[model samples]
Target: MFSFRNFNIADWFSLYRIMAVPLLVAFIWFGERQLFTWFLLISYSTDAIDGYLARKLKITSARGSQLDSIGDQITLVMGLIGLWFFENEFVLANYQLILLAFLPYVLQMIIAFRKYGKATAFHTYLAKSSAVLQGVFILWLLFFGPVYWLFYFMVIVGVLETIEEITLIFMYKEWVEDVKGIYWALKDKRRLKKKSVKNPTS
Candidate 1:
């Protein structure tokens, strides 16, 4: 997956996020919150750009989807680590709320890996909204501080997205890429055809 020879433009953009991790960590190590936040913002921007380019250019593939998800996961973890390190007081005060929002996400990951042996790249509408809110909230908190309303909204959307992901996992027996959501999953010809193939008599 890390093979440079196999990477496309979108993949390279996705790769940028992973590559930025060490630099982000260094910013934290040096207590450079401003630099870290700006770099983090750029990393998040690449998330949107890579997906847009992949869809616009019609170069979407399973490998690309998986790679994108991996990059996103790494970036998110780094963002959270930065948040914890730089905003230790806020994190400690709200650790319960944070864990409340994170537990289900961890469960969703476990379920996906158990069932599909890989991470999902559903990229559902709710998931996108959640990701956007998360980035916004994280950046806002870093730049300013935690705004209760934004934090609440981000947590809500994140929980909803995780629930949707878990539901999608139960819906699809096989690993699929770029699923929009449960509604689309129900009407998905690929999934339906696979089901029929497995249960021809049904």
Candidate 2:
């Protein structure tokens, strides 16, 4: 029911990425606890497949890019939220700790969107590795339940991943370009807003 009606072959992977949403939701919401574990694995698998197929088929479109970003956010962010809730329900950790780790990543997403007009392209190897590590850490925490030591381990890993991203962003010089683009766009936007305020008709 979900597949786009036009393609016989290329659409299969796109369909998979779309399908992962409800599957993930169902797993987290109503499925057996053990089954929810599969959700993470499947969602990530589809992430890989969709990316590969999009590049291999040369069918990358703006819509596809947006869809992929939304899908990823839904899975990763929502899953983390779910884990945070689970932690609360079980008295696993202070809910505040989850917020502390989560907020930075949320800010990163917002900054990337504002600056680059897209989520960091998935093409960077270290970025992908960082994502995978983050996902694994979250899943492990979910499955094993939280431990104080595990929390420390995750913090260390998370810091390392952040460092990797910072290094990679600078290594490519795309960071400067991203910042410059956003700076110019915002400056122009603000100037236009000011002019509009001064002259109502023009």
Candidate 3:
């Protein structure tokens, strides 16, 4: 649910990212490299801002997490689109590796929706690190150009993060929020509770 009339300041930031997608897309379509990079940077920064504000103000909720994840996915796709447009030759050169890292990501989304009726929001540390590297790699490519070292590192982290997310999906029956990663999941009472529910005699 949107909490229509009750959105807090942190929620507003998340909403901004969602609402700004059209603008980001427009920049890409118009071939406005600098404009796209600047606005995308702002959009990416809001991801961090919203999360910090939610925690600091104690305003976190399931709705906020969902909104935040949707915003993140959209903004990231927009960034990748921008990368493809601005750095065509570079992307063309490494398209194989890109697809290799990207396929697992798509699979993870499919599995999450099928299993829990929604995408995940585990927000694991590995996931966060991947996001940071992705943002840096894309923005750096747009602002400067492709840095091979960073590109390889981003791909490795991206694949690892995708694998971690997919693993977590199997670890929890229902959707979860803010699960640090698989290690934290091992100690998660929510997972244990759900398991206990399934095997009552155990």
Candidate 4:
């Protein structure tokens, strides 16, 4: 169902964000402080640009939407990991007891991807807020150092996101049906394209 590669600015912006994932990974893995910070800013800029382009140009597509979700996850995950690498004690040292707290996230991601065939529910405000919260938390951690109170703040935000996704699964069971419909539509388009190629005048 991914279909947003038609020179749309929104698509370009989304791709820009996705492309930064590698640099983020490298920065974290290699511990490049300056490069890491620059990429982080670029990543955030990409986020803002994509959203702005989507709204201003009305170029939102299924592929663009999916890319947005993936971009959010990758950016947050990599950013947090990078922050962890740079500021280890603040992250783990402060919240040692809540280490297993992320187990739920792992399970949730599994269910969201495997069972639901969705990286995330696209239309949820909570999902967006969760991403923003994580981004803010990472920036704050980097600039302000470890603030233990942020752990509780993140816990609350994360819990809301968890509940939102879970509730959305149940509330919108037809999401799978919608995906099936999209698949069928794409299949029809391909068949039409094949027929056109085979028969010059149909």
Best by TM-score: 3
What's the alpha carbon RMSD for model 2? 8.4
Write down the worst ten-residue block by lDDT for model 1: 190-199
Ranking by lDDT: 1, 3, 4, 2
Candidate 3 at residue 144, lDDT? 86
lDDT, candidate 4, equals: 0.65
* lDDT values for all models: 0.90, 0.56, 0.89, 0.65
The candidate, 1 or 4, that scores higher on TM-score is: 1
Which residue pairs does candidate 1 place in steric collision?
none
lDDT by residue (tens digit), candidate 1, 1-202:
3588988999999889989989999999999999999999999999999999998999998888888898888888888999999999999999998998889999999999999998999989998898889899999999998899999898988999999999999877788888888889888986757867887997
How much does candidate 2 score in TM-score? 0.58
Q: What is the total number of backbone clashes in candidate 4?
A: 0
Model 1: how far residue 170 lies from native, Å = 1.1
Better of 2 and 4 by lDDT: 4
TM-score of each: 0.94, 0.58, 0.95, 0.75
Q: List, residue by residue over 101-144, the lDDT tens digit for candidate 2.
A: 56666666666666566565433443455556667766776788
What are the RMSD figures for all models against the true structure? 1.5, 8.4, 1.4, 9.3
* Tens digits of lDDT, candidate 3, 1-202: 5766988888889889889989988988898999999999999999999999999999998888888888888888888888788889988999999999888999999999999888899889998899889999999889988899999999999999999999989888788799898899999985658967997997
Candidate 4 lDDT over residue span 1-202, tens digit each: 5545465777777777778878778877777866887778778668878878887888776667777767777776777687678887766665643444455666667867765677753435555666666666677667666566765677677776665565444433333221222224345453335546766786
Ranking by TM-score: 3, 1, 4, 2
Sliding window of 10 residues with minimal summed lDDT for model 4 = 174-183
Residue 113 CA displacement from its true place in model 1, Å? 1.2
